[model samples]
Target: MKNTTTPPKIVALALLVFVGAVMLGYGVSRMSAQEPQGNPVTGGLLYDKWWTVTGADAPVGDHPLWATQSTNTRTGADTWRCKECHGWDYKGADGAYGSGSHFTGFPGILAIKGQPVADIVAALKGSTNPDHDFSAVLDGQALLDLAVFVSESLIDTAPLVNADKTATGDAARGQAFFAMCTACHGPQGNAIYFDSFEDPLVIGSLSSDNPWEFIHKARYGQPTFLAMPALYTLGLADSDVGDVLAYAQSLPGEPALSGGGLLYDKWWTVTGADAPTENHPLWATQSTNTRTGADTWRCKECHGWDYKGADGAYGSGSHFTGFPGILDATSKSSEELLAWLNGEANPDHDFSVVVDEMALDALVAFIQQEMFDISMYVNEDGTVAGDADAGRSLYAGTCARCHGADGKIYNFGSEDKPEYVGTLAVDNPWEVFHKVAVGQPGAPMPGALALGWTPQQIADVVAFAQTLPVE
Candidate 1:
C-alpha cells in the first residue's frame, strides 16, 4: 500500500529519459547531413597545377593553331593546362599577357565562378573544346573540387579600380601597411625584375594600371611561389587590401632622370623641327640637311633673334639659313603652337616624324618650361643697343665663329623687312636667353650644359646679339 504512490513517480521519470535519447539522435543526424561535401581549398591547389599536352612525346602533325597563332609547338603535358592559357588572376586575353606572342584573346574563366558545378564539369570534360578535353587528365572528384573553389572563392575587382587606373583608398593608411610587401618588391616596389627584358613589374605601375590583379594576387598568394602566404588565411579584410593598393599607387612609376640628357643620341631625332630650306647655306654643307623624312633638323636655321637675312649675323654666313623668324609666335596660344607644329601655318613645317610619343612628351615639357614674351627689348627702328661693350666680349667667345667679329657676316635680314641678331638681342633678350639655354631642339646649337655656360653667360650672349644689324 506504501509503494503504490512511488510507482507512479518512477513511470514519469522513465518517460523523460526516453524523450531525451530521441532528441540527441535527431541532432546528430542533422549535423552529419550538413557537413561539407567537397574540399574546395584542395580544388584551388589542383587548378594551379599544370598538365602536359603530350608529355615527352613528339607531336604527330603541325599543331592546328600554331601556323596562325604561335610558333611554340613543342608541347609538354603541362603546356595546354587552363592555368597556362589563363593567368591565376583569370584575365586571359584582357589581362597581363594580353599582347605579344602569347596573345590568345581567350576570355577569362573568372566570370563563370558562380556557375553550377555540372556546367563547370562539362567544360572540363570535352564539352568546350574537343582538342582541349581534360576529362581523362583529371578525376571527377578533382573537377568537382575545382568547380566548388571557383564558384565560392573567385572575386570581382571592378569596384576597387578607378577610371584613372588608380586604387580608390586611403594612401596614407596603405603606406603604413605595405611594409611586409616591400621585402621582395623593394621600398619603392620596383625590385622584382621579370622575363628576359629585366622589366620590373613595379607596385606603382601595377597599382596604377591593374589594381584588380594586385588584389587577387595579394589575397590568393602567387601560384608558383610556395613561400608566399595567402593573405586570406591571415584574415586580412577587404579594406586592408584597398589600403595597400592606395599606398602602392602613391609611389613613383618612372625612374629619376640623369639631368635631361639627350633622349636619343641624335639631336635631330630628339626634336621634330621643320625641314631645312634647300637654298639655305647650312643645307649645302652636310648631307643631313638634304635628306628629310621628319622635320627635326631645322630648329636653329629659322627664328634667329637677328631675323634679318644677310643684314645681320646669320644672313650671308655659314650659319645662315634664309628662313622666316618666329617673331609672331610669342602671341600664339597652345592650340596655335600645336597647329604650327602640324604645319597649319607653313606647309614645310610638319613635325610628325622623329618625335615619337615619349619624345613628344619631352618636347611639350620643354615648350611649357621655356615659352615667354620678349616684346620689351626690341625697338620699332630695329637697331638694338643696350650694352655693346659687354656684348662684344660675349660674342667673341660664343658667337664669333658663326657671325664673324663684326656681327655682319651672315645677313639674316632683307632691306624691306629687316631683322638681325643685333636687333633681336636689343629687342627680345628673353627669347635669346631661352634658345641659348635649351639649344634649339633639332639644331646643332650647343646646349648651355655642353657649352659649360651659366644663365649669366647666356644673357651676355644675348646682349652681344643685340648689337648685330637689324636691317
Candidate 2:
C-alpha cells in the first residue's frame, strides 16, 4: 500500500526514519548489557601482587604457565607474581626481562593496550591459552579490574628508566618528596632490610639496581605493605616519580650495619627468636654480673656496651662480666669469625645454637665494620675529645630536628627517672658514638656515616649532646 500511494521522496524519508529508530534501539540495548568499569588503580596493584591486593593467601605451587619458562628460577609466591612473567616495562620478551635471570620468553600486553575489554577479559579467562586461565585464583570482578587496567592504565616505561637503571630527574626536588619515606626507610633508605640481615639489601640498593621495578612499586605501592604511599594515587606527576628515583639512587647502598648493632643489643629481639632458656654456654665463666636469662644471652652483656668488656663500662659495675670483648674480633678475618660463631673454634663461644647463619654473619659484619676503637674519642672520664663549639653548630643543624633545640625532647627513661640524649652521651659516650656512626636500629635515626660525616664529626655531635639537660 505504501509503494502504491506514497511518492519516492516520502518512501525514502520513512525508510531512513525506520532504520534510524532501529539503530538507536540497538545502541541502547548494547549499552544496557555492558558492565560498569572496574577500578584501574586496584587493577594496577593487583597486577603487582594479586594476593596482597585481594587479601588472599598466595596460591600454592607454581602457576600453570610457569612450567613453560625455565630462565627465572624463583619458586613459590614469587613465580605467581604477574611482573615475573610480564616485564616491569610491560614489553615482556622484547624488554628488560627478555633475557638474563628474569627471562620468561612471554609476549607482553603493551601491544593490546587499546583492545576491547571483553576480549582482554576473555584472554585472561584462558580463551587464548587454557594454561593462562586466572579464573581459578581470581573472581569475576578481579578479572574485570585487571581488564580495565590493561585497557586503560598501562604505560610505556621505556622512556622512563634508562639502560643503566638510572632515571633523569632532579635530586633536590626528590629529596624533599622523600621526607614522607623517612619514617620507615630512614634518611638514607637503609632502615628496612629487604633480604636477610647478611645480604642487607635495602630500598636504596633496590632503587639503584632496578629503577623500573622501583618506579612500579612507587606508583602502585608495595603489596602486603598497604601503608606504603603510592605516588600515583597521591597525584604525583611522572617527572616527580623520576625525581624520587633519582634521590633514592643517590642514597647510600651499603649493608645496614645498624641491623647488626640491633642484633648485638638483643639478638632474640631483632631476630624474633625465643630467648634461650638456659644461660649462654660462656655465662658460667663470668661471676660478677648477677643478670640471668635473656640478659645473659646478649652480646653486649659479654662484650660490654663499649665493646671493651672488662676494660670498659661493664668492667666492674652491676653489668660487669669477666668475658672478653669483641672489639679485637674486628682484626680477624670473616672466615675466622664465622668459625667462632658456628662453633668451629671454641664450642662454648658458638652463637649458632640460638641464631641463624645470616644473623651470625650480621654480627661478624658489625664487628668488622662498626666496632671502631672509640678510646680516641671517649676518654676514661666519660668526656669527649671533640670541638664542643663546632659540634653545637652541627647538632643545632641536624640532631636538633629530632632531639629538640635543647636536646630534651625525648625522655628515654620514665617520667620519674627521666633520661634525655644528654644522659646517654654523658653516661656512655662509647654507645653514643656507635649509635651516631651506624644509626639506631629499628628506628628512623640517621647515621653520621650515611650522612658522609667523619669520625671527628660524629665525636663532635656526641660532645654537643653531652651538654644537653640530663634530667
Candidate 3:
C-alpha cells in the first residue's frame, strides 16, 4: 500500500467527471419538461382574427362579457385575440398577468389542451364566456385546438368545481340564452312539457334538475335524445351566453300548477277567465255533481247547440244533467249576463274570479252574436230532418273522443235542478243548433267551420243529437 500507485488518483478523477455529466443531463431534462407545450403557431394566427357585423361596428365598448373592454382600443386584427384577456399559456389572467390591472379573475384554458375538440369549440363559440365570449372571433377548428390544449395540459380543476354549475362556468351567458327561450315556452318554459308523465321540465328544472347535462348541452347542443333545438344553430353571440344561464338560475324550478286544479275540481281556478261555462242543456245529468268535474267546467254541458237541453239531446242517457239550457239567455243583455256571473241573478253560481271581464265579454259575444234557431230540424219527439245514418258516420270520425257516441258522459245539473239532453229537446232547440255549429268553449271540441262540414252535414248532426238520450 505504501508503494507509489497513481491508479487511485486516476480512478477518483474519472468518477468525478461521470457524476458531473449525469447531473448536467438531469438538469436539461427538468428544464425541457417545465416548458409550455401550447401551439403558438395555430393560437397566434387565431388570435388576431376579426368578424364583420352587418350593422355599424358594435358600439366600441360593448364586448358581451367584458362590458368595459373596448374593441376600438385594439387596432385592426388585434381586436379579436383570446390572448387579450387570456395569456399566451391560455391561463387567462391567472398566470403571469394574474396580479396586473388586466387581471379579470378568469380561469386559464391551458389545462384543457387534451379535451375533445367539440368542447373547445363550444367554449369559444360563447359556450363558456358568460361575460366575454370570443365565439364570433374563432371558427370551428380554431376552437377545437384551443379546447384540446386546455383539457389535456391545463392545471386540474376538479377540486374547484362544486356539484352545481355555479362554479367553473360563466353564469351571465347562461342567463341570456334563457330569455330567448322564454318567448314560445312562457317566462318559465313550463307551459308545455314534451314529457307528460315525469315532472314538467322547464328551463330552471332542466338546469337544476341535471347540471352536467345542462353544462354539456349548454356548451355543445342538447343531446339528440331530446327535442331541444341547438343554440349554435341560432348563431347567438358569445357574450349572450352567461346572461341566459344567470336568468335561468334565478327562475322557479318546481312544477307549476301541478295538482292545484284537481283539489278544487275547477279548471277556472288555474285557467282564470278562460274556464268554460254551462251553456249546454244536457250537462247536469251526466256526472255526479253539477258544480264539479270536466262537465261543470264546460259551457256545452247545459245548453245544446240548439240551446235546448233535455228538450233536444239530453232527454235520455248518461249526459242528462237537468240544468236549464241557455236558449232563454239569447235575449239577455251583456250587462245582465255579467251580473249573473257575478252572482246577481244566481248568487250561488258566482264565477267572478274565474271568469274575468274579458272572458265575460267573450261569453256575451257568443250568446248575442252566435246563438241561432234549430226548431225546424229538431222535433219535440227527438227526431231530426236530414239523416241520422250520415250523422253517425261523422260522429265516429270526429266528435267521439270527448262527447262519446251517445253524446252523454258528463252531467251539468245540481241536486236542486234536473236537466238533460231529452229535456232540452222538448224545451229549447235553438241552443243545440248554436253549439254544434260554433263548437263549445274551452273544450277540445272541434268547430264545424274548420272541419269543412256543410250546412246539410250540420243538419244531419243535429238530427242525430235529437235521437240521443236526454233523460
Candidate 4:
C-alpha cells in the first residue's frame, strides 16, 4: 500500500501508454477496412441529381446552403445537388465550372481521396461544418455510398486523359467493347444530339471534349437518359471504361452514312419537325401504309421498311405504295440524290423545306451509300433463309444481353400484343432485317452491318429468333 501511493506519476504515464496503444490499433483497423464495394457510378448520378436518382419529391424552396453563395443564379432543388456545388469533374470551381453557368466557389472533394473514410463520412454528416450537413436528407447508407465513391473511386484522371480530354487507353480493343453501347448511341455515337439546336452535341464530341464527363456518364449513365445503361452495373472493369473512352474518342466527329435512317423511318417524330400545314402532296398517290398525319410522312411507309418499295415487304400489302425501291438510288451520286430530295429530280419527293441542309445531306448520304437490297434474306411470308443453328450462336453473343437467353426480357409492344425477337422474325422478318442492318429508327438499337454482321448472319439470327416465342 505504501509503494502504490509513492508512484502516482508513474501510474499516470503507464495508463496513457495503454490508451495510446488501443487508439493506434483502432486506427490501423480502420485503414485495413476502409472503402466498401459501393457503386461509384450510382454515386456520380447521385451527385448529378439525388432526387432524380431516388425518385423523391423535389425539395421545397431553394437549398439551405444557397444562402451562403450568391454567384450561382440557379434556385430551388438544383442548388442542393452535390455536383452543382462540387462540379462534375469533382474539382468544383477549380475545374470546368470555374466560370460557367454552373460556377460555385465550393472546394471539390477530389483532394480527399485516400483520406480516412471515417473523416469523409464525418464531413458529409457535417462534422467539419454544420452548413455542409447532408444527414437530414441522405440516410446513413446514402452518405456511406457517397463517402466510398469519393475515397476509392475518385481516380486521378489527369494521367489517363489528355488536356484535350481524349483518353490514353487502347482504342483498338475498345471498339469491341463499344458494341454494348451501339444499341443506343449508334455506330458513330451520333444517335442523340445532347446540346442545343444551333450546335448539336453528339457522343464523339462529348467524349473528345470532356472525357472525364464522358467516363462519368459511361460509368454511371445519364440520369436524364434512363434508356442508357450504366456499364459499371454490368461489371465492366475500370480499364474497360477507359478503353471505351479511347475507342469512342476515335469515332468520327461528324454524322455519316445511315445517320438519317431514323429520320427516314419517321421524320416527323425523329426530327421533331413541325407537321406540314397541308397534307403531304404525295399522300393521295397511294395509301397502302394506311396511316394518317405524321405516320404517312415517314419515308419507310411509302418506300417500305426493306427500303425496296413495290419489290419488297411493302410490295403488295396494306403497307404498300407504288413507289420505286431505293436500291437503285444507292448507285446514284450525292448530287443526284440531293436533287431528288430537293424537288429537282421529283417534285413530290422534295424535303428541302422540311429538313435543314445538314439533315438533307444525311438523308442523301443514306440513299447514296447505305441503301442495300435485303429481299434475298427475307421472304414475302417473313421466313428467313439462313441456318437457324448458326443464328443461335449469333444470338448468344449479341441479342442475349437485352433480350435474355430465351429472348423475353423486354416487351417492345403492348402487353396485349407482346413483341419479341421470335415474334418479329416470324411475323415481320423484313422489319427485323432492316433494323438489324441500319439500327432501329429513333433508337440506337444494334445495327448488324455496323458490327460487321453479314446479311447471311442476320438471316441466321432471324431464323433462330423465329424459333423463340410468338407471344
Among all candidates shown, the one with the greatest lDDT: 2
lDDT string, candidate 3, 1-471, tens digits: 121111344335334434544553465457558853333223333332223211224334434545454332444333344555665435665654365555555566666666676666566776765545555545554554355435542332233234454434455545435543432244454433333213346657765544433433443333222223334334344334344545555667643323221212233532433445443233333563335544554545554444566665655455566656776877998889778666777666565655455445556655665454566666655456677677666554445434556665545455566555434533554455554555433333334532445556766766666677775
Of the two candidates 1 and 3, the one with more favorable lDDT, higher being better, is: 1
lDDT of model 3, residue 277: 48
- Worst 10-residue lDDT window for candidate 4 reads 1-10
For residues 1-471, could you state the per-residue lDDT of candidate 2 as single tens digits?
011112344335334534654564465457647855565556778899899889898888888888888888888888887788887877788988888998989888888798899998999899999988999889988898788878876777766678877878888888766765654466677755665444567778888888878888877677666545566655567888888888999988865454677788777766667778888878888788888888888877888767888888777779877777777788999999999888999988788888887788778888888767788788888899988877876675457656777878778789899888999899888878877776665554666665556788878879888998887
Candidates in order, TM-scores: namely 0.37, 0.59, 0.31, 0.76
lDDT of 4 by residue, 1-471 (tens): 022111344334334434544554465457648744444556767777877877778787887678887889999888888878887678887876778688778887789988877788899888988878988888766777678778877755566677667688889878766765654455677654555323556778888977878887887778775545666555567777788889988887654334566567766555666765565778888766666776666788778878888877777868777887788888888888889888898798788878888778778877765666777877777777888888876776567645777888877789898998777778888777777666665554556665556678878888889999878
lDDT of 3: 0.48
- The lDDT of model 2 is 0.76
Q: Flag regions of model 1 displaced more than 4 Å.
A: 1-105, 136-145, 183-187, 190-192, 209-212, 235-239, 252-471
lDDT per residue (tens digit) for residues 204-295 in model 1:
77667667657766665555543333454444567777888888888766422211123312334333344334443234444422334323
Q: In model 3, which regions exceed 4 Å deviation?
A: 1-294, 304-306, 373-471
Give residue 311's lDDT in candidate 3 (0 to 100). 66
- RMSD of candidates 1 onward, in order: 26.7, 18.0, 27.7, 15.0
Evaluated with TM-score, which candidate comes out highest? 4
